[model samples]
Target: MTNQQTLPLPMALNMTLGESLAKRRTGRAFRANALTDDELSTLLWACAGLTGDEGRRTVPSTLNLKAVSVWVLRDDGTWRYDPAKNQLTRSTTTDCRRASTTHQFDFVTKAPVTLAFVLDHDVANTIRESCFYVDAGTMGQSAYLAATALGLSGCIRASFDHKALGEAMALPDNLEPILMFTVGLPEGK
Candidate 1:
């Protein structure tokens, strides 16, 4: 995926949902290895990629609004997952991984991929504030299960600086940053 903006992921999964669930584990540390383009593509697809021709996705959404925006922060830069195209669009070229999270944990930057699950306030408010969180959790779980299947590790964190993150991505005021996920090879890998 070097010098490339879009990546196509394999449609078939190597592991079943049950297998992925049983193998799922969290990590607090990570190796410096980078996640392959296919790995990132599959993970993002499992998280929020379109699953059908009817605009359905891998995870359920609140009020069927599909209001959550998945942001990918990597060592190279940041991108926003566009489900419709099944690709990631470059959000910035600044390698804002460190600024993606509040400097609370060192692993945030060490991990190869950091996902910020943002919410569109207008669409989420249509149902309830809690709906957004519920949808976000489902997406996060999708990422975790995919990582487990891929022989990788990841963790979800609530600690992040909203203002700084917004500025880092140059995001609009309507998109509210919520939960986050940091994933990569475990420390020894």
Candidate 2:
């Protein structure tokens, strides 16, 4: 959100809240195809992109701290989303599929995109854990609705190698990987 180069997103999709809610659902199976730039932009916007001035986020957080950091993980690379700027700054160029998903399921990596929600666990440990869960789940649900509205599919999964992912992503020492939402077109599509 600071001085880093930013990628401006396209206009967000116009959809009623009711329509997006009705379409909301979880997805596991994924097709190996790249998402259009617009689709990707909309998905990230729905997750944590800025919707207004003063660093407001789509999902509400405890004290508006917005501790959750979204990392867009793809086969080619990974990036951190800057909500205020509505942009992504590259995190790593090495392939991270193996680091993004767990042994419990392979579909996570199979999906074209995995949005990883990381946090400062030390801060979480010092506070009520439920707040963290609520905030993270709020962001995850936003992604699901966005995917559905775009006729895409996604899954919020907890089964991942946290240590490996953090190591692979070269996360800062203070941060900890918490949850992941995988998104992509269905196989039949």
Candidate 3:
């Protein structure tokens, strides 16, 4: 475990569902600006944090099994998103952006933030693989909308080197990368 700073997160915005839905778009042009810590906290909370006392999350998980985990990569280092506590725990101090697939937008490496969604295969099981993907898709879309509502640009991609990422992040064999969402300010119109 690495040094971490636990900060309080703000309440969810009052944006209407239609507004969030209409604002949703896959933005590949990300401004080379870092996202504020608060903004990052809000985005992570909106994706999978606990929203109610019963431990209900912002995104629905099948059978109440929160089989997905979020790992964030930034210029500083890699950290794991702990929704239970609404904080980021440092995982590694290496920059692994170059490990991402080349055909992806070239600016990905320069983006301020990248979110990787990891699925717990052990929890999903062979019979629930499809469900896990569906659940992850829902969470990923929520992340996109949340980023949009926060006035940030983001793109959801699934073309990263999973084996390398898993090893670098020190994720258990049961955890597998499902998708990556690169987020930052929009570069230009």
TM-score of each: 0.92, 0.89, 0.91
Candidate 2: pairs in clash: none
Order of candidate numbers by lDDT, starting with the best:
1, 2, 3
> Which one wins on TM-score?
1
User: What are the lDDT figures for the candidates, one per model?
Assistant: 0.83, 0.80, 0.79
Compose the digit string of candidate 2's lDDT tens values, residues 1-189: 232335557556677779989878887888989888788888888888777888887888877777778888887677888777667777777667678776735687678888888887666657776787778899899998888878898889888888899989888877877888889998798
The backbone clash count of each candidate, in order, is 0, 0, 0
Candidate 1 per-residue lDDT over residues 1-189, each given as its tens digit: 443377766446788888988888888789979988788888889889887788999999977899998989887787888888767787677776788776645888788889989998877665778878988999999989988988889998778887788788778888877889899998876
lDDT of candidate model 1 versus the reference = 0.83
Winner of 1 and 2 under TM-score: 1
**Maximum-lDDT candidate:** 1
Error of 1 at 26 (Å): 1.1
Model 2 gets an lDDT of: 0.80
- Residue pairs with colliding backbones in model 3 are none
RMSD (Å) per prediction = 2.1, 2.9, 1.9
